[model samples]
Structure formats: structure tokens, C-alpha cells
Target: MPSYYDIDAILTDSQKVPCTFEITVPGLGYLDGNPGEPIKEGTKVELPLWLGEMLAVTQNNTNTPTLSLDLPQCLSARVVNALKADPRVVDIRALAPHFYALGSRMLELFDEEELLDVLTDTFKRRAKEIADQAHHPRGVLGEGAEFLRGLDESERQLFRSAHESSKAVRNWMVDLKK
Candidate 1:
């Protein structure tokens, strides 16, 4: 089965925002930013979210990293602009999971309803276009149809209405053929 979620994009985006956490165990290796020096126990340090999550999971003793709200707004704006410019050219399927995760985190951290609303609207519009393309394959959407088939329930919900409309169109076409 094709994978719908873009793991690479998620990992890349996660690394963009650094977070601070304290090491509770000794001799874990160098912190991402503070290289060459081994991260000693009880040493507070800043690390990218991707590395932080890794260390936290592996060590099982580090403090939970506090996410910094430094990039979500800018990232959201960029995503919105890119989708607005050309929904067809841009790979919404590739970025949808990352954008959704970041937007959810931003909402929790800052409660910025307006930004989240804009992001959500932009994503829905892009998803609608992608769904339309799914009915009539072209360009990336040709391959994207397979990717769309692999979307998780939550992600699929974004294009649910569009998918339903497309289904109706397909059924009508079938009837006409008969």
C-alpha cells in the first residue's frame, strides 16, 4: 500500500524549531547545538525538536522539551501563500500532515485562532483542488491519487466533501456510459 503521510517533511519541519530540555542521565552524547562536549546529566540545553524527541524517547529521563513558538506563523503564511499561488503544482499531500501537526501545536501553544483558521482554510482549498484532480488525473495528481488513497482517517476528512462530489460525478458518468 502507498504511504500517504510524508515522513520526511514531518521530520524536516520538526527540526526547524528548537526546544530546551534538561538531561537527567549522564553520557548521552553531544547536544545538537553544543557539539564536541558530551551532554552531562542535569545539564539544560537547547536542541531541535526532532533530536529532542529522539533523546527523550531513548533516555526516558530527560524533561519534556518545551516547544518554542518561533516559526509556526511564518511557516503557516508560507504554506498558505504557496497553496494560493498554485494548488496543482504544490504537493499538498506531502505537506498536509506536517502543516496539520504544526498548526495543532501552534493552536495549543498560543491559541491563535485567526492564524489557524487561515491555515485550515488554505489547506481545505488545496485539498479540494487535489480532490478535483483525483477525479481527472493530471500532473502530480496522477500519482497523488494513489497517495490520497493512503490518507489516514483524519487527513482524509479534509477532502471528504470533495471526494463525495467526485463520487457523485463518477457515478453519473458510469450511468451515462450504461
Candidate 2:
């Protein structure tokens, strides 16, 4: 997912260069509801990409179009509807003389091994790519540079001789391992 945000301008009575300042904000965040913050009325905030993208967008906005981050929502039916339709949610049902029913063994149906296998496969593919790059190094000293031809990294910090900048291509591969 990609992070996305919107910019806003707030007009204030000030003595500086401009009365109105720019406000930028990441569209997606944890959405912690707090007192007295501005929320975009109908925006549906998504996860993962929202945080990082918001920062980049705000940085690009500079002083004007300044970011107003993590704003709070106003009281509205749209907000109420979003909460009610949340997939994991169950509405509370009020009834007199209602008794509990037996629970189902649904939790046991989870495929833990399949999940782990997918994760492991992804990591292994990444590792193999790094290792291959190490074994067959490429660098920029020339088209056929003599960088990291046979070297692999052992630690997070990569060091290469200044004379062998061309030989440092292996670090690029080693970086994948990290």
C-alpha cells in the first residue's frame, strides 16, 4: 500500500508573512479519537502505507499547506456507520431471559503451519537473492568493475576499501540480507 495525505490551509489573525497557514496530514493512522481535533468527514483511513506516506507528503508541503495530523472526527452519521460495519464487530443485542449458547471450536481451524510456510518462503527467497548477488558481484568502477565478486557480509555494517569502491557492489547484495 502507498501512503497518502491531504493538505489544508487555516486562516488565522497573525502579524507574520501570511495569516493563513498550510496544514498537511497523513490520511491513515491509528486514528486515536481525542478531544478537539479535526477529522476529514468522510475519509476512510487505511493502514500500513498511511503513516510513512503522510510524513513524506507533509515534508513536501513545507510551511504553507502545513500538515494537520491525526485530526479527530466530528459527530456525524458517516462516522457511526463506519464503526457499525467494521468486519470484526458484533452488535450488542439486548433481550430479557436470554441464555448463552455453547461456543464453537472455530479457533482450532486456523492454519498456523501454512502461515509460517508462506513467511519462511518469502524470507528464503530474499536471502537467496542476496547470496547470489554476493557470489556474482557488480560495481561501478567500470562496466566490468572488480567489486564484491566473492564477498558476503557478516555484520550489518558494511565496510569496503576506498580504493575498491567498484568492489563494493557485494554490499548492495549483502544489504538484502539485513
Candidate 3:
């Protein structure tokens, strides 16, 4: 399960989900299910709002959830490190399932404001399941790029672009003072 914030988006055409997300990773964006879908970088793309929230929530939280627009460098790294240090995760490193089986019961709730509550509850349950698996059965990505690699292509590309941009912003911080 992933955590989510209270971000809002209006529904667009059925073709485009209510939320749009632009992906900008050179080779990361591949519309595996939607054939011939153009992969655009440095541009805006609309995806289902639920998808965007998933990306957003996972990026923001370690175990507890917090919403901050700016990437929390130390915080994100701390969670990743904690997960990595966990004995359960380290021992299961060898199975390397390549992907965790997300419960089909999992569904993204968005496009309507009311769904947020439903989403909130769903996210908590899912997060608990994930944390459990982290501590016991099944392996995890250890809360970083390593964990992110476990994502499917579409989601992975989205994260890559966000991460790449965040890195650029972080690198420019020192120069910004000048």
C-alpha cells in the first residue's frame, strides 16, 4: 500500500485520466499496454489521478505520511536506509521476485473529491500490508531507487522524471545563492 495526499484534479476526457503527469526520462517511458502511445519528456502528461497520487504519496512518506512539495532529502534517505538495514529485507534480497504482486483489491480512488476518504482508508490498509511484507514475507525495494525499480514501466518513468528534476533542483541549490 502507498500513502496519498489531498491533491485534487478534475476529470478530463476518458482518453486522458482526470490527472495528467508528464514523464521525461530518455528511455524509461514505454506505454507497454497502450501501443504507440507517445512518450514525452519535459512536457505534461495526464494519467489517472490515482496514479499520480500513488507516485506522490510514496515519494513523500517513509513509514508515516507527510506532504511537502519540496523533496525532503534527509527524510527520504532515512527511510530508505532504515528499510535497507532491516534484516527481513536484507535476507530476502536473493529471491529478487522482480515485482511484488499487488493485491487486486487495490484500486486508485480519484477524479471525485468524495473518493479521497475512501482512498485514504485503502491507502492505510495497503501501507500496512507493505510494511508487514517489508518486515516479514516477500521482499521490498528498500525505499529508494532500488524499491522504485520494482515499479511497472509507466509508474517507473513518472518517478524517474520527477527524481531527475528533483536532483537538478538539488544540485542548483548552491548556485541559486549566487
Candidate 4:
């Protein structure tokens, strides 16, 4: 579970997921942009993950779920295929700023083995690349600029940590020699 005050968690939960109403919801049309109308059954709407997950697990008067949630577009087949084909080339930051966090959240609601494997593999590959880029002294105008730009928030943090660690180690070596 994510910490309540974690900004990344908040942003990840704010990502939209497609939802289909399982039952008619009175005065809930505001979600679909109509304030006064009721949301009819089977109406598909894009809702933030937080609201959608709540509605998905909540039981209606008939003992049925209020709605069903679908995978967000960011995790659609195309993106998954792209990641599988070449994880390094996919610009995950453009898809979602908190891509890994969103994936972890979705995994709690879903039981897709392939998605889990793909995400884990993708993260491993990307983390290696990020570490390499961070350790290597590439000036601002050098290679890997595009790849760095495509890193999601977590990957950016990893890059920063690796870069700082490398610098600290170099400085320590200089001090030892002095």
C-alpha cells in the first residue's frame, strides 16, 4: 500500500481507468459531465483510479458491484507490446509520469501474469540503462539525452542517486589521494 501523503501515490491514483456502470447510479452523471442526470447502466466512463476502484468493489443494493474497471489506456496492449519488443525505446514518462507506481496499483486489482512479467522485465532493463547513463560522464549535449528524458519519475530518481553516488565516490578517491 502506498503512503497516504505520498505525492507519487496520489498522482498514480489520479490516473484514469475505463469503467462501465454495472447498475444505474442516480445523480452520478456528473462523472460524465451531466450534473442533473443519472448515469445509466452499462455507460462507459473514464474515472480516476481511486474512484473507479472504490465503485468497483462497493456492492449495490442488489449485492452486485456498482461498476467494473478496465485497464487504463496507458497499459493497453500496444504499450505492452512495445515494452516487450524494446523496453528501452518506449517513452513511459509520456504514457504516465508514475508508470511503475500505476502498474503496481493495477496489479492489486488485476491478476494478469503477463503484465507482471513484462513490467518486471521492463524495469530491470531500464534500471540497468539508467545506471549506465548515470555512471557515464555524458555532457548535457551528449548521447542518451532522449532516453533520460523518457525516464519516468522513479527512474529519474534512480538516475539521480546513481549519478550522485558516482560523484561522491570520485570525490572520496580524490580526498584519499590528497
Candidate 5:
């Protein structure tokens, strides 16, 4: 579970997801760029996860949800297939800054075993690359610059931690050598 003040969690929730309305919502046309008109039934809109999740899970008088959430385009088959082909090559940051975090949240709402597997494998593969980049002396001018730029928020943090730890260890070793 994400903390109440987790900025990454907030951003992840703010990311848009496609939603199809099961019922017409009156005076909510602002969501679809029309004011004062009801959003019609079967209308599809891209809504933020926070609002969409609430609307999706809420039971109306009929005991059915008002709308249904679909996987975001960031997690579409194309992106998944790319990751399956080469996890290190896909620009996950372009898809979503908090890609893995959003994936975890989606997995909670959806029962997708394949998505889980792909995400896990992708993370494991990219983690090795991130660690290598962190330990290596290749600065921004290095060959891995493009790959480093594609890392998601969590991976960025991991790289920072790994880099900092290595730096700290080197400093400690120098102090001991004195």
C-alpha cells in the first residue's frame, strides 16, 4: 500500500485510464468536454485512476458499477510485447514516469497473471542493467545514456541508491587506506 503522502503514488493515481460508462451520468459532461449535458451511456472517457477507480467500484442502486476500467494504453499489448522482447530497450519513462507503481496498482484492481509475469521479468532484467550503469564509470556521455534516460521512477531511485552506495564504499576504503 502506498502512503497517504507518497508523491509517486499520487502521480500514479493521477495517470489516466480508459473507462466505459455503464450508466449515463447527468450533468457530468465536463468530463467529456461538454458542460451541462449528461455523459451518455456507453461513452468512453480517459479518466484518472483515482476518479475512475472510485466510479468503477461504487455500486449504484442496481448493484452494478457505473463504469468499467480498462488497462491504460501504457500497459497495452504493444508495450508489453516490447518489454518481452527487450526490457532494457523500452522507454518506460515515456509510457509513464511511475510505470511499475502503476502496474502494481493495476494488478490489485485486475486479475492479470500474464501482466504480472511480464512486469516481474522486465523489472528483473532492467534491474541488472541499472545496477551495472550505476557501478560503471560511464557518465551521461556514456553509451548507456539512452537506456538510463528510459528508466522509470522506481528504477531511477534504485540507480541512485546503488550509485551512492558504491561511492560511499569507495570513500570509506580511501579513509581506511589513510
Candidate 6:
């Protein structure tokens, strides 16, 4: 099954702005001697956004950090490009649920409505192409088909219609051969 979440995107966006962290161990001299007070074990300190994320990941048991981010609008464009490049290799729908959840939690996280609309439009267009091509005997459903399957209820309905149309065409061809 295809995953329906973009955890890396969420993590990246979440760590966009610098935030505070509670350190649990010592010996992180690299992050010390900066503008702010030196980071020490057992003390709370503020760190740069990227640094904080790195430290939190590297020193999981040693730091507890908070993050907030404003997801960039370009993300959707990137996704669209990836889908266009190889809809069979890219599952754009995988990001829908995560986008929805994150957008709900953080209104400013992303242009949720716009992203959803764009994704739906792109998926529909690509799915139609796939369906049309599917009538060929050798056509193979790939990641694009999986992406369509992962769509939300309404979007899935659209894919289902296209798929049904393709099926009908295939049956008609078989009847003609008979």
C-alpha cells in the first residue's frame, strides 16, 4: 500500500523557525559559544531552526524541542513537477492526508485549499490520460494508478468513473473480437 503522509515535509516545515530546546546531556560544544548563552546539559536554550532540528534528531534523548513553520507555496509546484515527470513513479496523493492534518493544525502552514485543488486537477487530468491509454492491450497501471486509489472519497469517485470507462472500452473490444 502507498503511504498517505509526507512526514519529511511536515518535519521540514515544522522546523522552519528557530525554537527552544531542553538539553539533557553535555558535550555539545559545537552549538556552544554562539551569540546567546552557551548550551549546557539540563538547561533550556534557543537554537537556530536547522541546528535545532539536527540536534534534536542526533541527540534524541538529550533534547526536547518545539517547532513551528509556514509551509512554502512552492512545495505544491515541486510536487506537480514530480508527478508530471513520472506519474508512475510518484504518488502525489500520498501527501493529502498529511497536508490536511497539518493544514488543520496550522492554518498558515500552507495554502491548503489551493494545494488540494491543484493536486486534484493534476490527478484528474493524468488519470484520464492513463485511462485512455489503458485500453491498449499492453498498458500497465503503475504508481499513477496507486495514486488514484489513494485519493479521497470524491476524487476516488472520479478515478473510478474513468476506470469504469476504460473497462467498458476493453469489454467492447473483446466483444468486437468475438
Each model's lDDT: 0.53, 0.28, 0.34, 0.93, 0.95, 0.48
- Candidate 6 deviant stretches above 4 angstroms: 1-65, 69-77, 80-111, 137-178
Write down the TM-score for model 3.
Answer: 0.23
Candidate with maximal TM-score = 5
Q: Give the better candidate number (2 or 6) by TM-score.
A: 6
Candidate order by lDDT, decreasing, is 5, 4, 1, 6, 3, 2
Over 84-133, each residue of candidate 3 has an lDDT whose tens digit, in order, gives 44422322122222111111112223133333343344334334444443
Top candidate when judged by lDDT against the true structure: 5
Clashes of 4: 0
The RMSD (Cα, Å) of candidate 4 is 1.0
lDDT of 1: 0.53
Candidate 4 C-alpha lDDT tens digits along 47-144: 99999999999997799999999998889999999999999999999999999999999999999999999999999999999999999958777889
Question: Local error of candidate 3 at 23, Å?
Answer: 44
Model 4 scores worst on lDDT over the 10 consecutive residues at: 137-146
Per-residue lDDT for 133 in model 5? 92
Candidate 1 runs further than 4 Å off: 1-16, 20-29, 32-69, 72-97, 139-178
TM-score of 4: 0.97
TM-score for each model: 0.46, 0.22, 0.23, 0.97, 0.97, 0.32
Model 1 C-alpha lDDT per residue in residues 3-104, reported as the tens digit of each score: 447664454345445343444333444553455555554555545555554554453433443222244333556766665665445544455345556555
Tens digits of lDDT, candidate 2, 1-178: 1123311101110101101113423442234253245433343332222332343245442443333223112112343343334411211111101101000011122234533343234334434533444444555453323222222221011223332453566677688889
Candidate 5: Cα lDDT at 44: 96
Clashes in each model (backbone N, CA, C under 3 Å)? 0, 9, 5, 0, 0, 0
Point out where model 4 deviates above 4 Å: none
| Candidate 5 lDDT over residue span 56-169, tens digit each | 999889988999999999999999999899999999999999999999999999999999999999999999999999989588889999999999999999999999999999
Q: What's the lDDT for residue 115 in model 1?
A: 66
